[model samples]
Target: MAEFHQSRKNIIRLIFIGVFAVIAMRLFYLQVIETKYRQLANAQAIVRKLIYPTRGIIYDRHGRVVVNNTALYDLMVTPSEVKHLDTAFLCELLGIDTATFRERMEKIIIRNSRYRQSVFAELLPPDVYGRIEENLYQFPGFELVERPVRNYPYHAGAHIFGYIGEVDSATIRRSDGFYQAGDFIGKTGLERSYEDVLRGQRGVTYLVRDSRNRIQGSYAGGMYDTPAVAGKNLYLSLDIELQQLGEQLLQNKIGSIVAIDPNTGGILAMVSSPTYDPNELSGSERNKKFSRLFTNPELPLFNRPIQATYPPGSTFKPVDALIALHEGVITPQYGYDCRGVYLGCGRPIKCTESFPGHASNLYNAIAYSCNSYFSQVFRFIVDRERRPALGLAEWYRYVSDFGLGKKLGIDLPGEYSGYIPDTAHYNKIFGKGHWNSCTIVSLGIGQGEITETPLQLANVMCIIANHGYYYTPHVVDSVEGDPDFYRTHLVLHRITANVSDTDYDIVTRAMAAVVERGTATIAAIPGITICGKTGTAQNFTIINGKRVELKDHSLFAAFAPREHPKIAIAVVVENAGFGASWAAPIASLMIEKYLRDSIATDRLPLLKRISEANLIPEYILEKKRRIDSLNQVRDKLEARRIVAR
Candidate 1:
């Protein structure tokens, strides 16, 4: 009996020890191993506030601050903490009706949980903020939070600088908790491309709250507060004056101009016409203005420099000349007696210059932009190989090396890969063996099935200027914090074409002749040696399911100061007729402006003519008118609905 009682007592003691160990482990897990319960408990007494750092400033090449920040306030609300709120007073302060206030509150609750804070009124005007701040203590859950909004001092570079907006659900998901609702993010252009470098680290502050949900002081004496790191500034290669001039010249027109510094491939100016003020998409009216811009028929939002594509037209002749010379099919002195037209194919292809011996050699041929001469050259190249496919593949390889038919990987977003037809493309269209050089002769003249962006055309000029090498074109010259940004991002890319430097020299001379006395003579600047090419791309539109030819698109590509070219530029004026009339003159003025920093008195008249010209298509104008009328009607209806409510 004594042994039994001792064993039972010992078992009871072991049970007590096991229970104590389990209780101790549970306490440790809850206190140290898990954060959910602790955070939930802290949420009752501590309000965590996010501090948004100032977005990086943007500077032009000359160190002018082009983009800066302005202080704005957002009326934030924590729905759960909103007790005994004066709905009418709040509505009156916000300049909103009770219905609108309730609607906004409902949306906030839906988007963010009732316990969390959300923006009630964003980008509040200074006057409105002053009024709300005076009475903010009357609203229990409402807080005025200061944030930085972008400001464009010059009101230029609407497309280049882009805009930022509140983060969407998709963006929040993609950010992996880095972004939340009400966080602003870049939507396009340099803003979108350099978002990471421009958006600085966010900081957090823990504030102690009393039982009434009022902030008392910094939680834990500010021990856990983190300071926000301001975003790194960006120094851009864009010459603001040059950019402004380009925009001025392209006003009331549908076109694009891209100018690059040949030595560094830094974009000097990029202009897409019909541009709006950058301020239109900032501050309080951003959403309303953005909606209108998005629906505009002119497509002002489109980044035409790298997004729109057009045939290279005669500007492509130099590339063909180089290719022919490399293939040994034509020498620099090779002559084609192009008298009006080429008769090698069943169909006749006419030359722009009908005079005899106009295209007597490669130099004259390029200077004259003779279609017949290049057609024969393309035929010789294709027919030289046993199969036309092999010849086309070779041509494709050469052109692709010049950065056609692919994205140039420019620093901007939404770049379109211009199309270049190859053997496979022809095979799919006309069957493998049925198509030959004659079937696709237009490719030689950069017309049928060959397309390139203005960026690509400018890049081609850079290659010619550099004797077959180019750097990836970029806008940002350097980031403030990172010194190796340019070297690491905008590296030199050499063309793999087998053409020698002599071939480039031959082409360069011919291009100079083009500006000196040939097709683009009007593009000549008095002191600057401008080597340029004129292009008139045939444009077409589908009207009522029928292909309708429209006025040709005027284009010009050029490099200045022939010996050591500083600037390479491309201009495309949509539906503006002959290249020399619109595009060439524009290029000349731009070149002179960039080189001299001002248009000469002699050229001001030409600049005035080009700048005042209105080339927007009639159809586009009619469409815009119709859209404006519809928008007016919609606005009236919205007003009526609000009045009825």
Candidate 2:
């Protein structure tokens, strides 16, 4: 009995020892085998970081920096580290209020984990950095991380340079590569046009940290980290000096100024008045004041040169003349009797001319901007009986060829293809029974339901200057890092804008006559052949429940060195009556400035001092009365009030 009991106790002890050994071995296997992965996970929690690449620089043709990058710090926060942080001290240091700080924290909490970091402040200016650096320890969760912010150096072309802002949610969902939350992208202009070239490839850096979550140094001394590739520099086709002059010329006006190289179709200057500084939109405060400008009733944000559509006025007459000449509808000597009126449907269409009915040849018709001549020509077009039954159809075809009623396919964003009513379009509106050539006779003088962009108007002028051929008007000369820099990458469309040479010369001669002995005498620049046409587009507006026709929208389209045209320009001064009075002088000044280069304008001082001659005595006083009266009377009144006091 005693021997059997001892055997049972020995067996029990052996079983207990076996169980203990198995447990120890399993614990040893787990600690030794899984150590590597645990170390990696720990390292990731402390030191993983992303580095964004800097955007490319934008340069003018002269290699002058128009847009560049500046180093800025993004203040970030780790939510878990916010513990024991001084909230008021942090708010004061970062120039943010308590409510803003709380809101930002709440947003971060909702979007990110307590263990991860979130961007709390962006675009910390140098002065703000100085203040924050002084109180770094007070904000335990905050970190200053370096990033590049866009900068504009020259302030040359604000509208064309565009601006960048943080990528919106819509942009991210639509885009695929190299973009994440907190990334900036081009919002407009060339920046938006060539975002891929400007935004370079991003790089990554691996780091090591202590057990307490402090970065020690780069892992393997950054061997695994690739440096960010800098963006390719871009050289634009814009002449900075010329762009400045155009902007200066358009000051105090609510219109656009678009100048293009007639030969190359490269835009020299595209100015929209009431422009905001692009520098205003480059930084974090962008959202604060931009809404005001963008929403202004004048629509300063609108790029008027390409976006706003208005009646081309008589600037469009050249297109009619060209089409008529090309189609052989009117000969160079095709004369019309302008008894100061045009008989639309055999009803007299009134003209600005005076006298008991005079016959005007084509040359005189253009010089006089004769309504009767163009009315007859338009009737001859839409009145198929006068030509072919398809003359109106063919006229529409030529109008489309001129790029009216279509987008010119310019590089700028938000270009509008202004309305050009076709037969079908008229049918839709008038139900096919209500309209005819006489129904839209005002179109003969660039009125009626016809509409066009300033760019399209300029292109028409360019076609006239080319005498037949026109290149597609473009703003982007070339992309960055393309072959043979500085040469404008000509983007001539596959469809060549070609017209009959004989027809072109006929219109050219008529335009030359306009500057010489016709309505646009104000556009004459000595020593340079400038062919121009003036337009007075009567603008009807209702005032106090009555429809009144304001004097006109002053307009002029001209080309210089008529034999070999270099530049073609179109100027529209809104509500400034009479093209010859306001628009002609501006066009003439621009032409003189272009050809004679400041020396031509040097003659202006002598002209201004001619005491014996006041060619526009009433006009000058009437125009300046509102401008001069304000300062002169205000100054005297202020002085008198002060004396009385």
Candidate 3:
């Protein structure tokens, strides 16, 4: 019996030893092997704040600061660290009501856990920040964090520079853990396209907190801290002075202009009318101003240069001229009897030339902007092979080579591939083999479903200037410190119309004559040989359930100096009559300005007239008046210390 008791005691001792061994191993794991628990404990006690680096400054080609950064403060809060904070006083300091206070607090809690920090009120200007800063100590769990906000010096380049805003829920999910709520992100334009390069790396700093979660000093003597690197600077090819001039010229108008250096494909200027101060879209009043802009009749945000597609009008004649010459269907010596109309299509399509054989050859036809000459050329292009579809298919190839009906893959976003119809497309529209060249004769004159962007039209001029080749036009010149930047930006494309330089020379001479003494004589500049084409696109709009014809759009495409073209430009002024009256003259003035650095003394008066011409319709002006009056009433009511209903 004693022996049995000894064995049982031994078993009990072994069980105790096993329990202690498990405890010791767990202790070791907690202290050495597994550090997750320790890390979590440290996280609660150490407040980590992101140190945002300054965004890089944007410069024009001439080293002008187009965009720079100014310091702003973000009021951050740790919900768990709050004591008996003065809620009402805080509301007054933040210029918010009680409802806003509750809403912001609720959002903060939802975006970050009670223990983690989040933004309370952000983008406070310096004056407001200075007022609240002195009393910051009275509010616990609240800290002022400094970050950079974009400041536009000229308030120009509104659409080009874009704006920054809080990261949306969609962005957070799409970013796959890269971005978090309350993070600032680029939403459009160059900001969105170059985001990866523009958003500098975020850095972190850990601050020690007591048991009560009050800040002390840096955690671990700053061993775990990281310093943020500033974003890389961008050098754009845009000439700010020229850009501002174009913007001024297009003010109160409803169209766009695109100018490019033909040799380098550098965009010298891009202007989309009805511009707003880009500064309005930043800082404390961004939301309110954005609401006003959103409801404005004139689409200040439309980005017409790249996104708006319009009928090229007579500006498309050069492309057709080149196509006809390339197909071996016509030569520079081809002549047509045009008595201001064409009778072969069984309908009267006016050529606007009074005499027969007026378009005696390619030179005279283009010089006169003769429609009848090209109408016959169009039929030949579509009917020469006996099957009109086959001939049209060949014609489409040449036009496509001219970069119409397709996106040019510019660095900018929201570019539309202006429609170019194929034989299959024509078959769908009008039954297969049923439509002939006469059915779509308007295509020859750059109308009837053939459309192009202003940038594409500018590229047409660039193509003619180069005689057959072009680089993809771009605004970005290079990224600072990146050797591969230009390599990525400079891309060349060659268009083979199979036409010789001799053919282009003939077209150039004809265009020069058009500017000198033919259709667009108003576009001539002293000592500057300008080649230009004038076109008018008929416009219509729907009103009161009826289609009403408005004024026609004025369009012009031009290149200067004839032999060595410096600038190629396309201008379209909406609801402005006659391309010669507005678009061509605008292009000429712009060319003179670029080449001579100023308008000649004689042309200054003409420039003043163009700038003062308010093409914005009277109805739009009246609507703006009503909106402004209403806003003034609201402002007066608020000033009287009355609450808005």
Question: Compared with the true structure, what per-residue lDDT tens digits does model 2 show for residues 451-536?
Answer: 88878888888878876667778776666668753254464542243567887888888889889988888677777888888887
For model 2 the local lDDT of residue 472 reads 78
Q: On TM-score, who's better, 1 or 2?
A: 1
Q: Which portions of model 2 show Cα errors greater than 4 Å?
A: 1-45, 48-50, 109-117, 209-215, 346-348, 355-359, 386-389, 484-489, 493-498, 540-551, 603-645
lDDT of 3: 0.86
Q: Global lDDT for candidate 1?
A: 0.90
Candidate 1's C-alpha runs over 4 A off are 1-45, 92-111, 209-215, 639-645
* Each prediction's whole-model lDDT (CA): 0.90, 0.73, 0.86
**Residue lDDT tens for model 1, 500-554:** 9988899999999898888888888887899889988999888679998889999
Write the residue-wise lDDT of candidate 3 on 1-645 in tens digits: 999999999999999999999999999999899977776677668888878877777889899999888878998888866779998888777767778888888887887767677888888867778878999989987889997888999878887777878898899999887777767888767887787878887788989988876789999999999998888888998888888888888888999989999988998998888888888877877877887887777878888999999999888888888877877789989988888887879998887676665599898898788888888888988999889899889889888998988999877878888987779988998999899999988888887888999999999999998899898989888998899989877899899666789878888888998898878898898798998898888788776789988898999999988989999999999999878889988888888889999988988998899999899876677878898788789778765642321
Clashing pairs in 2: 342-349
Q: By lDDT, highest first, what's the ranking?
A: 1, 3, 2
Taking all chains together, each candidate's TM-score versus the true structure is: 0.91, 0.84, 0.92
Model 3: how far is 429 from its true place, Å?
Answer: 2.1
Pick out the ten consecutive residues of candidate 1 with the lowest summed lDDT.
35-44
On TM-score, who's better, 1 or 3?
3
